[model samples]
Target: MSRQVKGVVSMRKGAPVELRTVVVPDPGPGEVTVDVKACGVCHTDFHYREGGINDDFPFLLGHEAAGVVAEVGPGVSNVAPGDYVVLNWRAVCGLCRACRRGRPWYCFDTANATQKMTLEDGTELSPALGIGAFLETTLVAAGQCTKVDPAAPPEVAGLLGCGVMAGLGAATNTGEVGRGDSVAVIGCGGVGGAAIAGARLAGAARIIAVDLDDRKLELATTLGATHTVNSGRTDAVTAIQELTGGFGADVVIDAVGRPETWKQAFYARDLAGTVVLVGVPTPEMTLEIPLLDVFGRGGKLKSSWYGDCLPERDFPMLIDLYLQGRLPLETFVSEKIALTDVEAAFEAMKRGDVLRSVVML
Candidate 1:
C-alpha cells in the first residue's frame, strides 16, 4: 500500500523549501522504505535549494541520514525491516568497468530506486542524491541503505552517510594517507575535520588543519589535528611547509574546493605527496597552475567523490570505530535540530558557528 509521508520539498529554484505531504508508494521489487530518524543539513542541501546541483526543481532535499528499514520489497536479501541503516549515495553496480577492474569504489554506474516519490498532483520529485530523508519517511533503492551498528545514535550515524564519511574516506581511502605521515587539511568544515580525524585514525603522526575561522580551528583541534593554521592571517603554504620542516606535509587535502585553497594544498605538500580534492567546486571557477610546476610536482592529484566510498564496506567499519571511541564521530554533531530548524542551521553553518546541525525527525 502507498503511504502519505511528510517531506521538505524545494518547489522552485532559489525559493525557501516547504514541508508538504509526499506520496510514497510501497517498496518495489528492490526498494525499501526508511523511517528517517535523523538527517544532517549539509551544504549540498542548500546548494540543491539554490539550484546549484541541477534544475531538478521540486526536489526532495536532505541526504545525510540514518533510519530504520520500515519495509522491503521482494528479493531483498541484504537488509530487513527494523534494521538501523545509514543511507549512502553509491549503490554499486557490479558490472561497471571500475568494478570489473576490482575498484568498486570507482564504479562508473550506481543504482537507486526505479520508482519515484511524486508530488500530490503526481509530478515526479527528484530526490537530492537519490536519497531524500528530511521527512518522517523516505523511499530509496534497497542497495542505497547500508546497515550499521544498531547501537549507534541517529545523529552520529547519519553523518557517516555523507560529508563526514567523505572526509574520512578522502584521507584513508583516496589519499592513502599512512602511518606517521604528516597531513594538512584546508577548510576546517565538517568534511575537513573528518579528514583530520581520519588521518589520526589511520595513524598519521602530524595532522595540520588550515582554516580562516578560530572557532573552526578549535573544533579541528578537538578532531585530532596536531596543529592549526588560521590562513586568514598567514600564508597557508609557507605555514604548512614550516610546520613540516619546510618540506610540507605527506598529504594535503583541499576540502574547500576553491582554486586558492587547492593551490595551497598543491604547494604545501612534500615531494610526491598526495593532494586530495574533496571540495565541491562550481563551474564558474577555473584554475591555472604554471606548466613547469605542474610537471615538476611529482605527486598524485586526485579528486574524491563521496570519498570514493563503498558504502556497504565503509559505513559499518566506521560505525564500529565510532562506537569504540577510536573515532570521534560525535564531535561532528554541533547541534540537534528539528526539521523546521534546517534554515537556521544553514545560517549557523554560514557563520562558522557549528560543525553540523543534525535534523532529528
Candidate 2:
C-alpha cells in the first residue's frame, strides 16, 4: 500500500518550499521505508531551492537524517524493522569495480530506491542526494540505512549522513591527519568545524582554523581548533605557515570550495604534505594555478568525494565514539527547528547564524 505523508518540497526555482502531501510507495526488493525522526537543514538543500544543483524542481530537500526502519522489502536483510539507522546517500553496490578492488567508498554504482516518491498529483520528486529525508516517512535502498547505537539522539546522529561526515572523513580518511600532525582547515562552517573535531580525534598536535567569519572561527575553538585565523583580516596561507613554525601544516583542507580557498589550501601546506578539497564548487568555477607551482609543491592534491567515507564502516564506529563522549557530534547541532521552519533555516544558513538547524519530524 502507498502512504501519504507531509514533506517539504521545492516546487519551483528561487521560490519557498511547500509542505505538501507526498505519496510514498511501499518498499520493493532491496528497499526500506524509514520513519524519519530528525533531518538536518543543510546548504545543499538551499542550493537545490535556488536551482543551483540542477533543474530538478520539486526536489525532496533533506538528506542529512536519522530514523528507524519502519519496514523492509524482500531480499533486504542488512537492516530490519525497528532498527535505528543513519541515512546515507552512498549506498555502495558490491558488484562495482571499486567494490571489487576492495574500495567500496569509491563505488561507482551507488544505489537508491528503485521506485520514486511523488506529489499528490503524481509528479515525481527528486530526493536530495538520493535520500529524500524531510518527509515523515521516506523510502530508500536498504543499504542506505546504516544501523548505529540507538542511544545517540537522532538530531545529532543524522549530521553524520552528510556535512559532518564529509568534514571528519576529509581529515581522517582523505587527508590522513594523524597523531602529532599539524593540520589546517579553511572555512569554519559545519563541515570545516567537523574537520577540526576530526583532526582532534586523530590526535593532530596543532589544528589551525581559517575563516572569514569571526563567529565561525570562535566556534571552531570549541571544536578543537588550537588556533584561529580570520582570513578576511589576514592572509590564510601566511598565517598557517607561520603557525607551523614557518614550515606550513602537514594537511590543509579547503572546506569553502572556492578557487581562492583552494589556492590557499595548496600554498598553506608544507612540501609533500596533503591538500584536501572537501568543498563543493559550481560547474563554471575554474582554477588557473601555474603548472610549475603544481610540480614544485611535490605533494598530494586530492578532492574528497563524500569524504571518501564508507557508511557501513564509519557510521557505526562514529556513533559509538559519540556515545563514549570521544566525539562531540552534538556540538554541530546549533539549533533544532520544525519542518515548517526549513525555509527560515535557509536564511539563517546564508547569514552564518547556525552550524545546522535540524528539523524534528
lDDT of 1 by residue, 236-305 (tens): 9999999999899999999999999999999999998899999898767899999888779798999999
Model 1 lDDT at residue 231: 94
| Clash pairs, model 2 backbone | none
Root-mean-square deviation of every model: 0.9, 0.8
lDDT string, candidate 2, 237-332, tens digits:
999999999999999999989999999999999999999999888767999999999999899999898889999999999999999899998888
C-alpha displacement of 236 in model 1, angstroms? 0.5
Every model's TM-score: 0.98, 0.99
Candidate with maximal lDDT: 2
lDDT at position 280, candidate 1: 92
How far residue 254's Cα lies from its native spot in candidate 2, in Å, is 0.4
Total clashing pairs in model 1: 0
RMSD (CA, Å), candidate 2 to true, equals 0.8
